[model samples]
Target: MRVQNLVVGFGPQNDTDPVLNGVSFEVAPGECLALVGESGSGKSVTARSLLGLAGDNAWVRADELSLAGNDVRGLSEQSWRRRRGRDVGLVLQDALVSLDPLRPVGREIADSLRLHTRLGAAARHARVLEVLARVGLSDAGNSVRKRAGELSGGQRQRALIAAAIALDPPLLIADEPTTALDVTVQAQILELLTGLKRAGTGILLISHDLAVVGRIADRIAVLSEGRIVEQGPAHAILTRPEHPVTRQMLAAIPVDKPRGLRLSPRAAAPVSPAAAPFLALSDRADPVAPRNTVLEATGLVKRFTRPDGTEQLAVDGVSFRLERGTTLGIVGESGSGKTTTARLALALTRPDAGEVRVLGQPFSAASEKERRLLRPRLGAVYQDALSSFDPRLSVEQVLRDAVGGGRTGRGAASASAATAATAATAATAATASAADRLRVLALLDAVGLPQGLLGRRPLSLSGGQRQRVSIARALASGPQILICDEPVSSLDVTVQAQVLDLLDELQRNLGLSLLFISHDLGVIQHVSDQVAVMLDGRIVETGATARVFAAPEHPYTQTLLGAVPRIRF
Candidate 1:
């Protein structure tokens, strides 16, 4: 596959401002070429142009564009469709969105074989299972019957790869394929791609993660603002980058850094004077001094009844204490009970046995009324910020509602005002309204978001912006403890860096306790003061982050560390 002077643009007059401007690259047989850049850098647009899947509004042109000796430029929709599965296979990033949720995964694979090959029903079925197994799905027979939603993150990714490679196309295009996967699963996917390359298949890999690119790429092209800023051997580019953009991206990686060290060079927004008191509530004392325990769980055991009527233990005898003004990172594979433990900590899910205490008081075992009063002290930020927000609410509305709904002081005052004068009640309501607005604005500033975004809905915001809003919403409740579950998993490295830096600053200023859960060990090492490794619904290892990463005692922890992709430099 080769491209020279490729240009792609959208709208009526696309040539005025193209997304991909004069981009050129090549992927030879038995080799892999990677396009690395941040989001909106024309990586996905280039892939789409090659496959003729660029949207209807997009106009693509190239001085030379060919795949397997056939010119791909100006190909009709029907011709491109004919060449797609047989000539090239495309593996997208989000497998959950790519695969049909209602259909069995095997059918998705079989459809490709049925379209590209002259195979009978039985042959297609056998080929589906064969590819599934080849992609490392353990129980291919049973897996074929499961829908995409039924599978874990790694399993769904494998299913997507299985469908993409069923026809054994000469060229494969993987776009952010490992972006959402855990370290070990990402390593497996990288290995699979490497194996495919060794089999004489040309691969075009697109990713924002330089570490992942450095692991598998033979050649690397650094894309910046729709152009290739630097192109060379993978080792040379990663070890000694020439472009400023490349250097900035490398510096943004969170690995090999100590806690509280900023990942990005940008400074965090200062806390407003009005919001200062709220953030500094716990900051009055020495931050490094021996602090009290903010949250604790003892012998936590949670079970769920499966569809087959068999109970599955989600959290088994989990126990941990989160100290004030510190971070406790929970690291594990997809179904290792990391999220379940977080839910148990938040008191969102009740444990069948055991107890949780917040601020040295009973939490999980308390009544709903008691929990409601204490709820203002805790907040949560989830992985999918867009999905977590209400589509109907503007940014201002979301933050304002959070502030008004969770203000324990206001609630108590309102209860006392039931017998107070009506004029006094009106005055109090007006005062609260003004305070809520000020708090909302301050929250936006705290997250480095512009006040102009106040009127926009969450769906219109970018991935990073949505996450910032999520953080701001979590802060609006004046929570001393923040439960962040894979909060930065979906973001690109640079944005991830900024969010990490912001969290570090917020924690330092607010003295907040963080129960951070993630599958990314690099992020865990960066943000966590203490680390807990979970496996099979239990905590396998727990220690200081530095100690755990330097000298992992458990075999599982060692495996996770070994699988982490790292730049040679």
Candidate 2:
């Protein structure tokens, strides 16, 4: 398991130099070698080049690249396929997309075994179950036939790990494997990986999270702009870093401290006090609408039955709402009905019992078609935008599709065209100049993204860049209310602050209402007008954001707030 003089990237496009220069690295048996860098620094390209899977568009070159002493640069596709699962296992960033949507997760794991082993069907099944149990996916025996879509994010990640290690590969390459998970689940995945390392499986870990890497890696390589700036023991690199980039990263991590809120993490690097606040919820000069009687619910219930004959109540008699143009932040652990409540408001899902209304309209009862008509009234943004965007479509197409530019034929063009012509006669909304280009520019600028990135596809952008595009797209509809489901969960702290500030600006300038959902209590406190603490599918405490923080009325809220790791100076 070693590589030297390994390099990979796209060829010259209109005369630009190589995307990845001659990058080199190595990983020894039973050791964890970490590669750290920002997006497009060739972190993923180097990873893909190891298995000869970088694709036709990429030009791969290496002097000596060996996986178990077998030269990778010369290996044919059929030959590399044999080495991939058998000698070098890979767990990608997105477990959901990495796994086959058409196949059962268990069978995906089973397929790994069948490809590399001569074992019989029964033996293979037993082996797959064994690996799944090792990864702590309980009831592996029963979950063997479950489709990838049916599993949770953490569960899907566990399944991916199970598949990667099914053949007991000596080397494992994990690229941001825990990026999409909650902190607790992240700890669990780290524990499992560390346990495997102890049992003689060397790992090549790739991550943007320094803390996570600090906890797991024995050695670290700090990469900036596709170059390894520093390489040494993890402790030495972290506590006694010798590079400016490394120090810049350390400054970005949240440290426990006492302060009202220092510089907003939105700055590209550390900024002086003049920098903006992280997510200024107080941007509105006017007071929020009266706290009580603004939004309320009673006896709300939602339930689902699993394919394994297990019943799960996603939301049970839960009741909560928001003040007009004010943020009501919902804090809950995963599977605690946070997403369900958002869906109910957007009319994406129908509840079992209880009424849901937006400023007092029968929201939950609206038909899906009617809901689309009302869609412009309510906007949304999710945690992972790559999953939401069609990878095949360019970013321009995604926003254009959302803005009602391409659906004219199906929308009774003759009748709609007349209506548009009539309205255009009055305001010229349908005139040749009425295209949404200004709207697109305004939205992109609002989210702090340059207009130059508009032509690129979602796949070509960084995670943070992709998120900005999603925010711009959500606002493209110009909804009165926006529902954000952990929108910054996948971002670095610095990027997170930028997004939060952008949301704050939108709320202030456009008077947009926000239903902000997150597990981070600090974010909730900083941005929420009112806070609703949910636990086990119920809102245990609901009140003014400051009041709730000053004196949380519920034990669960107390516990959740207490668990928030404070920043140290």
Candidate 3:
């Protein structure tokens, strides 16, 4: 397959600003060509054009475009459909959103076979099992019958890969396949892709993660804006990058970086000494003495019954304490009980056993009334900020509700009100209106978003902007404890760095405690004051960030650290 001088644009207005500017690349049989770039760099757009999936408004032009010796430049929609799965396959990043949630995963795989092959239902089922096994999802007889939601993150990703490669297409396009997966699972997925390449499949890998791509890519192309800034052997580009954008990306990596230092491209200032007290060691001899523990979980255990009527332990005997103005990062693989433990900490789920204490008060066992009284002191940021908000609410309305000045389309207002300890202490009507408006704008400024966005809805915001708004919303209540769940997993590398820096800054300036959860160890190492390694529903290791990282005591912890991608600088 080859694409030379390829260019694409969306509408009449986009003609002058094409997404791809004369991009050119090639993929030989049994070789992997990695298209590396930040978000909106035209990597995905270039890949989609080859499959004729660039959408109707896309104006695609190229001096030469061919796939498997056939001209793909002017293929009709019908021709593209016939060639898509049979000639080429695509694996998207998010498996949960990519696969059918309602149908059994096996059936979804079978649909592709039915469309491209003459196999019967029985044969298709056998083929589905074959591909599922090929992708390392060989559970049991009924494994393929499980819905997408029923599978773990890794398993769901494997299912999507199986569906893509069911017929063993000649060319495969995998876009950020390991972005959200844990290190071990990410390694496994990359190994699977490696095996596919070895078997003589031409693969196009698109990603912002240079380390992951460096592991297997035979050739590399660095993209910035709408053009390929650098292209060469993987070793040449990674070791001695010539382009400034490429150098910026390499420098932004969290590996080997000191704790509390900003990882973003923007100018960074040292954490303020006047910030709230932290239990972590620091040079400041007179830093404020330790304050009371803000959150504590003791022997937390949570259980759920699966659809098969079998018991499943999501979290087991997990214990951790978070001090005032510090970050405790929880790192683990998918289905390792990270999210379950987070839910228990948030008091969103009552543990079957054990308990949680918030601000030195019993929280897990707290009644609805008591929980409401304590709500205002806690806030959360999720991985998907757009989904976290109501699409109908504009940014100003969202902030107003969060500030407890007006009714929110979602429960932002009620939640804020519930968290506030006293209605009497709440601002008066006139003062509330003025103060809330000012506070909303202040929050926006603090998050690095312009006040002009106040009139726009979430759908109109970019991913980075939406995440900033989510952080702003979480801050509106002035919560002492903030919980972040895979908050930066889906962001581009540069954006991820920016958000991490922002969170670190916020923690310092506000003296807020953070419960940061993620699968990326590098990210954990960058922002955490302390680290807790969780596996199979237990904390395998816990200590100060520097201590635990310097010499990991647990096997799981060591293995996780080993799997983190690093350049040989």
Candidate 4:
């Protein structure tokens, strides 16, 4: 697969600028080529343009385009349709969007085989299991029968990979496969891609994570403003990058290398011991004040009944407290119950034992009336901002409903009056009128979202902007505690830094208690004051942030820290 003088964009639109410039590169057959850039850098557009998947709105032009030595840009629509899956495979950033949620993942994988080949149902089923098992989804025969939601994040990713390779397309283009996974799972996914490269598959890996690209790609292409700035071997580009952006990229890969090369300037905020508690340290600071206690969970436990007739304990006997004005970071591996703990704390799910206390009252066991009373005290920020928000609704509507102040749709004025009537009872506790609309704008500004975004939907914004809006929505409820789960994972390092700083600033100024969850240790170290290491449905170790990171005690904790890549000067 090779791209020469390839240019793609929405073209010079009446309002918007062209999306891409003259982009050119060549990915060798059976080789891994990585395209690295920040959001809106045109990397994604370039990847999608290869198969002419950019749609009619896109004005794409390329001097030369060929896959497996066959000219692609000139193919007729019918030929392109036939050639798409059978010859070129694309793995999108969001697996849920790419794979139909209504169908089992197995049949989804088998669909391509049946469509492009003469394989019957049984043969296709057998092939699905074989390919899925090869992707490390073991005993996939039963897995193929289950719904896509039934699988874990890792399993779901493996299933998607299996589907992409099922038809054995000569070229596999994966766009940010590990964006949604944890650290360990990310390592595993990278390893899988490396193996695929060894199997002589042409892989076009597009990502903003330079560390991931450094680890996987044989060659690297740095795209900026829809144009290639630098292209070379992965080691060369990462180790001694020539382009300024490439240097920024190498410096941006999280401190995961464990050793070698000194970081330029300083990338992340200096780890602040004064911020929050973390890891295995033994200093118990006085409990943050009552108004500060936004969310607290004691002796929380959650168990799931598996299809295998066995009980899966998601969260077990967990205890944590978030006070106003601080970020409490939670770090753990996949299936280690991190997410379950988040849900338990929020009263989003029922816990088998223990109770959630929000703003100083038992929450999880609250009656319907009790919950309604405390509804305004709770707010949540999710991982994927795009799906969490309604596409049809504008940003203002989302915020209006969240703040419990307005009726935003057709009968907004009447609805607002009605909402005011029902909210009158809860209103007596706090602000009587409703949450201040000015505060909403303030939150948006704090998160770096523009005020103009109020009229636009989530789709109109970039990934970082959408995430900022989610942050704004979380802040709109005026909750004492804000639970953020991997808020920055979908963003690039620079964006992640800005968001973290914004969160920290907001934490201090607003006296907000934060329950933050993430798989990145460096981020955990920087963001948390107190840290708890959870593993296998249990808190393995909990201590002061600086102490635990300085010298971790638990073997599991040490193993995790060891897995983090480091850099040397």
Most lDDT-accurate candidate: 1
Distance from true position, residue 507, model 1, in Å? 1.0
- Write model 3 residue lDDT over 154-216, tens digit each, in one string: 899999999899988999999899988889999999999999999999999999989889888
Residue by residue across 1-569, what tens digits does model 2's lDDT show? Answer: 77666666676544556666767778888899989876556778778888788877777777778877776677788888888888989999888899998898888998878888999999998998899999999899877888888888888999999999998899999999877575556767888899989989999999876767877788999887777889999889888889877776665553332122432445322212222221122222324324333345557788889878898898888877666678888988788899998777666778898877654555677766654555565678998889999887777667666655455222123445566566656355344224555555556666777778878889999888898888777876666668899998778655665567667766766667788998767667877878888888988898988788878879877776654543221
Query: Per-residue error at 296 for model 3, in Å?
Result: 1.3
Worst 10 residues of 2 by lDDT: 270-279
What C-alpha lDDT does candidate 4 achieve relative to the native structure? Answer: 0.74
Q: Poorest 10 consecutive residues of model 3 by lDDT? A: 275-284
| Candidate 1 per-residue C-alpha lDDT over 457-562 given as tens digits, one digit per residue, 9 for 90 to 100 | 9999989899999999898877888999999999999989989998988888777899999999999999999999999999999999999999999999999999
Stretches of candidate 1 exceeding 4 Å from the true structure: 14-16, 272-274, 278-291, 406-427
Give each model's whole-structure lDDT.
Answer: 0.89, 0.74, 0.85, 0.74
Residue 210 in model 2: shift from native, Å?
A: 1.9
Instruction: List TM-scores for all candidates, in order.
Output: 0.94, 0.76, 0.89, 0.80
How well is each residue in 401-448 modelled by candidate 4, as lDDT tens digits? Answer: 665534334212444465666566445524522333455555555565
Q: For model 3, what is the error of residue 148's alpha carbon versus the real structure, in angstroms, after optimal superposition?
A: 2.9
The top-ranked prediction according to TM-score is 1
lDDT of 1 at 103: 97
